[model samples]
Target: MVLFLYSPLVSRGVAQSPLGAPRATLAAPAEASFAVGQQLDANLAAATAPLLAQGPSSGSIVTYIAMLSSQNVVPNAPMTEARGVVGAALAGDRLVVRGSFRELSSALRDYATDPVDPPNPNITSAFHIHRGSPSENGPFQYALEVTMNSTGRGGSATGDYRLTPEQIQALQNGLLYVDLHTTRNRGGELRGILMPA
Candidate 1:
């Protein structure tokens, strides 16, 4: 019976324990198209010139933000405290992906993604934006570039790359999703859907 009381972990929240409390990752900038825990300030001047410049006149544009969590991963990821939030917006011909995260098990692999309804996929390099539904896994379609960090089991990912009109639509329709891959879980550790806000 004493052996049954034994445990692999020192206990949750113990500093020396491997599965201890989560550490802080880089903070995601507050001034983005959208974000977690807060909404854009109600002010006209808040609209940055660069974002406004890429308005509808500059072809189709998309701005989205969502919370990432372990629950969203398809086939389910091993239980982890890993979580984060992501925001995206168009800048010129480039699409920027930015997010802050914490509690990853190890170094990140690829930030896999899925986009719906794009014909002739071209994204073969950089981190990819893939095509899939909330309940499905799909192929990569667009590219993104961002540095990932894991100091203290947390960091941020930021990248920019060109996106297509059809890809933008996938985001709008909530048919696309973003996920983070880690060394321990190459498939995905955290996932978030691009549903309309």
Candidate 2:
């Protein structure tokens, strides 16, 4: 790389020519002018807002990073060798769970954001988040939206959900699990406790 010093201005307002000669002093450019004070807009504020809860309860914000495997399946599908990872974020009463799941023993089906069919056809996820510990099967709580290909869905899952105070505590306490339902094992082909990625 070649750096040709064409003309660099000295701090004293004198211009130094490339030939190592000093030129006449040049007036500094005027400062830039603005109409307004450059106030922040709503979108900028919303985008830059901190994700974690703020204030005296800020310490309660929790992040869960964990994995899901056949080993974590409550009933134990020994024949299946599927695995998954969960990443979750809890800010105040809002929680979003997202993860990737693969290597299932059978075809995936019926993934959703809720147990009942979503009112809007646009909601096309079938993954289920249950309120259970590793040792037991719990009721379905939230549904994760997953993608579909020529094959069955459940290859990946993501969903943002509003939660109650109790639900928030349960999630922080590691009492929530992701349930992957396949055609063969309707109960749950694979399971992983959710934390955020």
Residue-level lDDT of model 2, residues 107-181, one tens digit each, is 765444333433544424446787878799987787777765444533666677788787877776778887777
Per-candidate TM-score against the hidden true structure: 0.59, 0.59
Worst 10 residues of 1 by lDDT: 39-48
Candidate 2 lDDT trough over 10 residues, lowest sum: 34-43
- lDDT by residue for model 1 (1-197), tens: 11122112212121122223332322555432222342211111121233555555654434555567778788875687777766565444555566666777776653235322352445332234567887887776554444555364666655555657777667667766777767676677888775432
List where candidate 1 sits over 4 angstroms from the true fold: 1-50, 53-62, 90-94, 110-128, 149-152
lDDT of all the models against the reference?
A: 0.53, 0.54
Model 2 C-alpha lDDT versus the unseen true structure: 0.54
Report the lDDT of model 2 for residue 57. 51
RMSD to truth, every model: 13.8, 19.2
